[model samples]
Target: MITWLTIIGMGVITYAIRLAPIVLLERFALSPALRQALKFVPVAVLSAIILPELIMPGGGVDVSLANGRLLAGLLAIFVAWRTKNVLWTIVVGMVALWLL
Candidate 1:
């Protein structure tokens, strides 16, 4: 039927999308700037997601003691800056959240 045909067509399109990048990128190298930008993309993406959860979990931009997520995020930032350990950062953030 039409629905089955549409599903098969979508499968082919998805496969082509996945294969195209591997086939295309194999013949090229990223420039230095592009490579650096790619490295920062994950940080930028995570910050975008985490910042909202931390700063505005309740839809409004709250910055008070009731905003425990924001304070815990700040503590996590401090732990990351001081020790640069992912484990310690999580522990500190968890403790801060529990305390707050």
Candidate 2:
């Protein structure tokens, strides 16, 4: 249970983190090579964090084929690949999970 002040403090901290990059990077101009490399940094970092959650969310890191979340996530990925729409992917994943 988060208190109001705690939530507000988290919001303030998050705000500061969000603003920090703009404030710090405003005066700098990145070179083309560096800019291209930097563009992938966020995706790499986000994938580093999200991949485990998608496939091995149980914290035990048990990647057995019997895992329901892994199956559901694969179904979601297939749906996303076929439809190229998040709404459809979510709907299909929900249906798969509900029926499982």
Candidate 3:
């Protein structure tokens, strides 16, 4: 009973924490510069999350050919740059990783 209650309480708290931003931000208008900068937020966040795993798969930096993730990430980067297609990039990256 206590575990279930704790989980329910955590759910409510998490919901409120996420909802607070939307509720509070709705009242104000953001500046044009700030809005434009917000466009890069997703890219920055994604890079932050993905670059570490690709560059350092085993808790240490690995930039050589032995690193499958690094090679796959490089291929994905090239695909994204050349084709600008998310689907192709993902497919190629996954296939490369599996092969490597």
Candidate 4:
């Protein structure tokens, strides 16, 4: 019972923390510059999260060609740039990684 209560409490707190920002933002308008800057936040955040794993798969820096994730990432980048298709980029990247 304690474990379940703790899980529910954490869930409620997490939801409230996420929802508070959206609720507050809706009540106030942000500056155009701030909005523009926020537009890059997702990309920047994703790069910060993903680039490290791709460039350094074994927990240490490894930028060599032998890195499967790095090669797969390059393929995904190429597919994304050329086809501009998110689905295809993911599929190709996954298949390339599997093959490598």
lDDT of 1: 0.92
- Between candidates 1 and 2, the TM-score winner: 1
For model 2, the stretches where C-alpha displacement exceeds 4 angstroms are 1-26
After superposing candidate 1 on the true structure, give the runs of residues whose Cα lies further than 4 Å from its correct spot: 1-26
What's the lDDT for residue 21 in model 4?
A: 70
Candidate 4 matches the true fold with a TM-score of 0.73
Give candidate 3 regions above 4 Å deviation.
1-26
Better of 1 and 2 by lDDT: 1
The TM-score-based order of candidates, best leading, equals 4, 3, 1, 2
lDDT of each candidate versus the true structure: 0.92, 0.81, 0.94, 0.93
lDDT of 3 at 32: 100
How do the residues 1-100 of candidate 3 rate in per-residue lDDT, one tens digit apiece? 9999999999999898678768888755678998899999999999999999999999999999999999999999999999999999999999999999
lDDT of 2 by residue, 10-69 (tens): 999999867876888975556799889989999799879867976777777767766777
TM-scores, all candidates, are 0.68, 0.64, 0.70, 0.73
Q: Rank the candidates by lDDT, best first.
A: 3, 4, 1, 2
In model 4, how many backbone clashes occur? 0
Tell me the spans in candidate 4 whose CA falls farther than 4 Å from its real position: 1-27
Better lDDT candidate (2, 3): 3
lDDT of 1 by residue, 1-100 (tens): 9999999999999898678768889755668998889899889999899889898989999989899999999999999999989999999999999999
Candidate 2 has which clashing residue pairs, if any? none
| Clash number for each model | 0, 0, 0, 0
Stronger candidate by lDDT (1 vs 4): 4
